[model samples]
Target: MAERHLEIEQKYDAAADFVLPELDGLPGVASAGEPEVHELHASYFDTADLRLAAHGITLRRRRGGTDAGWHLKMPAGTDSKQEMRAPLGRPLVVPARLAGLVAAYTRGAELRPVATLETRRTVVRLLAADGAELAEVADDLVTGCGPDAEPERWREIEVELKGGTPELLKAAGKRLRKVGAKKGKSSSKLGRLLGEAVVPAQAAAARAAARSRIAAATSNGKGPGITTGEVVLAYLAEQVEAIATYDPKARLEEEDAVHKMRVAVRRTRSALRSYRPVLDAERTVPLGPELRWLAAVLGEVRDLEVLRMRFAEAPAFVVEDLEKREKAAYRRMNASLREPRYFKLLDELDRLILDPPLAGAADRKARKELPLLVTRAWDRMAKDYASIKSADDPDVARHETRKAAKRARYAAELAVPVLGVAAKRVVKDAKRIQEVLGGYQDGVIAMEHLGTAAKRTKVPAEAFALGVLYGKEQCEALAARDHLSTTWSQTLGPSF
Candidate 1:
């Protein structure tokens, strides 16, 4: 079982011609790269209806590659893929547990074979000035066979970024171009697999960037309305990555993994409800029920974990303390929350994963519809910013700012692999706003907890302590809200 995918990198420029089909020796070369070849075969699984498309993922079982096994590929940012693999499957479909892990995206969609591919790989490595392997350039002669599409043959050279920058691709490119080893016209294997289905979100964004933001943010621009496509795609991509990144963590039962994964699930749902128009509701409307189930299950585990942690942070064995009694009740309730009820949850995830209830509608590729979607989402964000600008109440202003942050995050996440540094910078700034508001929300929750503790306590000191906590949070929230004026100004502009 080999966990494998071809990595294709295109270098921008180099000192000299680093073309392919190199002869034994070259002049003025300090060192050369070695290449090894491998035989690769992979069978990809997806619903005939394209259940995985909405989530931007593809699953497969592969053999003969360097790393082989059951592979789940979720979109990473713009152009990259986050490929997660498990050991050789005892049987196909997807292991119940493995499938359940991605239930948020798969929902009721079915999982079936969409395509199978076999490739004879020839490798050539590119090294640095130090003679270390800088990048892997593999030439793949491939055959793709599938149900919905035709069988095809293709030859491609891939330069995967293993331990180097995109800059390395440029450096290596100088030499490759001389021998006719030009950057392959396609972006990814899956992109080629889908053929005309591939959406050029980054390429679209490039064009959008050329236009004025104000023009795009308004309907006068050519894109979709705000909160429509951009937010949906962003949310879609984020959930897919969340599923892949947390897969290993969930299996390992790492602290807070369940909680973080659940948030990702919730975010996906939020995006769906938030931007219902731009997407084909026929496929997404049915998704809500399944998404709810996943969020509920994971949240239960997270809630219990949070309560357990709070209990540990409670004070000494003083019976007179009301806070102590609240802590005890919390522990007692949490103990009951972790029964067989949760044991079965992991299995539900499995059923959803291995046997999705996908309608054929989900399989349609929405790539051609990207710019309009992005523009729509940006419009909502811009409007929200305008609302904040006119807002007189600080609290109202802050809340509106939070909504804008979400829109920005949604856009950036969709373009992550595409927008590169610019998207990252936008997301980082918007996240700062989320953090400020999030802390204020935490204060509100903390105050409620303290009040509950106080009501259960007989001792005045216990009540006093609870009051102290409430007051502290209230003050914190106010200060944070006040600071937001300046923060929002910096982020959105002085008008905001």
Candidate 2:
């Protein structure tokens, strides 16, 4: 089992001649304990291309430290990381648990020892007036070697918070700066050792060129100053990053993680479908089904999660059954995440971002091209809304309308960067419609689940309770259906 916690710390580079500063008078500190010396060795592992380091993630197995183990540190926020630790089990092979967490980044790439670091350290503990340790300051002299690279040596300082506040961390950094310490060039030892390998050179150059082009176009005062392709690609890149970011959390079954990853998949698929004019359909069209496949996998888990929550107030047996089903769904989801099909989808998304297949309209100014696309999506939604209003059975029509509204909402959101307020208004209207219909759909599903539970249970009281819940949900579903026409009239007053 892996232990997880947040590691909030600051790192600074100092020359060999620099002296360690006294930390006794720092904020929230009454005294500094005597220095303790230790020698530590760590081997950092990543793919041949260093994918993990590029994303600010570090995986290492270390020895000769109080926290000696396999540590996987992932970015949590500025100046902090979520660190998961496992006991030192093997010397060479990466731990299975840690490797699984990083599968999203590795994508089947073989993990190898990319760098090794040996550190001679002196540590002092800063303590509060009551002798509670607030933070530890480590002055390290490091000798690091990367694959096929010469050994390099440097000196740095790290202040890792234990029971200290962020302000105290800032104060410690200030004290270190007064003694000539500067912010470290890289965030981690592996990053400093691997250097440009952490970020592929070709990708870096492309980003730089894109920035230059955008800057030149802005200065020229051209119409909207950006192309539709650029706007669409930016949105696609954001969704891709979100999917990777949430993959590990989803695998761990963390709260809301699966839903977030599913949303990213939906947003990516929606953008591709809605902006087909600006993108090459031959290259992007097939991705829709692939994305939908992944979304359905995640949706199975998410729907069960919602069902579990909805029945929290039901009988214990009902809640337990729902939980067992949810767990089984999660197991299926985890297996799907590790499938080659999912990895291929991720790789295709990356390639699409790096070398976008743009169509003829991609070169058009975004402000002009995007509104037309958004209007088309709005028109599609309006068509569905019309069907809902006239249909004899609105239940089936409402599901289609909800899906259409979602597509329209995603289209408008993508256009917001270029269209601003007008696009925002369309997004608001589409979101409202999506929410209303979505609630109705959830109610319908809940009623069905309740009905099933009522039939399966042997107990009379439990069956009666399930029956009452089913009736309540059916009434709510009908009410939502009744309210839909009025919502459409108010929101769909004038199409974009």
Clashes of each: 41, 0
lDDT of 2 at 360: 90
lDDT of 2 by residue, 152-208 (tens): 999999999999999899999998999899998888888888887778434334444
Could you estimate the TM-score for every candidate?
Answer: 0.49, 0.94
lDDT of each: 0.56, 0.87
Residue 136: error of model 1 in Å? 0.9
Off by over 4 Å in 1: 1-31, 53-56, 96-98, 101-105, 129-132, 148-150, 182-185, 193-496
Residue ranges of candidate 2 with Cα displaced over 4 Å:
200-223, 389-393, 492-496
User: Compared to the true structure, candidate 1 yields what TM-score?
Assistant: 0.49
Deviation in angstroms for 239 in model 2?
Answer: 0.9
